[model samples]
Target: KDTHDSLRDENVSIKKSYQDLSMTKASNSNVSSRAVVPEKPKVLAPGLYAMTPKYVPP
Candidate 1:
């Protein structure tokens, strides 16, 4: 019974730790996604400008 109780406690703690880690990962991904958004416009700008010249010449 004692061993079973200990195992249960350990399982709960492990689950809590995993939950915390998942939350941290989720928040980090959110931050990274926000950071990535600004870069997309910069990437698109160059492509648009490159195409503009080609279209203008034709």
Candidate 2:
């Protein structure tokens, strides 16, 4: 009985972990779409332009 209960508890925890991971992935996907993915700047003239990451923390 003890073993069965432990197994059930472990399964529940595993299921919750998976749910959290899925939620994180979904949120990241949404955030990624909302992010302004920067494109390579075309240098029309010789000038140094500061570059930044494509994704910025909201």
Candidate 3:
């Protein structure tokens, strides 16, 4: 009976760690994806608009 109780405690601890790890990974991915998305529009908009003024006379 004692061994069974110990095994149950270990199982609960492992599950808790796994949940925490998954949450961390999910949050990190969200942050990275958000960071990459804003940069793309900033770069494209400036490059395209800056050339428009020069090309307008031709």
Candidate No. with top lDDT: 2
For residue 20, model 3's alpha carbon misses the true position, in angstroms, by 0.4
Total clashing pairs in model 3: 0
lDDT of 2 by residue, 1-58 (tens): 9999999999999999999999998777765554453467645567743444664445
lDDT of 1 by residue, 14-48 (tens): 99999999998876665434222332243455445
**Cα-based lDDT at residue 46, candidate 1:** 48
**Model 3: worst 10 consecutive residues (lDDT sum):** 49-58
lDDT (10s digit) by residue, model 3, range 1-58 = 9999999999999999999999998776654342223332434554453233223231
Q: State the weakest 10-residue window (summed lDDT) of model 1.
A: 49-58
Give per-residue lDDT, candidate 3, residue 29. Answer: 61
Model 3, residue 26: what's the lDDT? Answer: 76
List where candidate 1 sits over 4 angstroms from the true fold. Answer: 34-58
**TM-score-best of 2 and 3:** 3
Number of the top-ranking candidate, with TM-score as the measure: 1
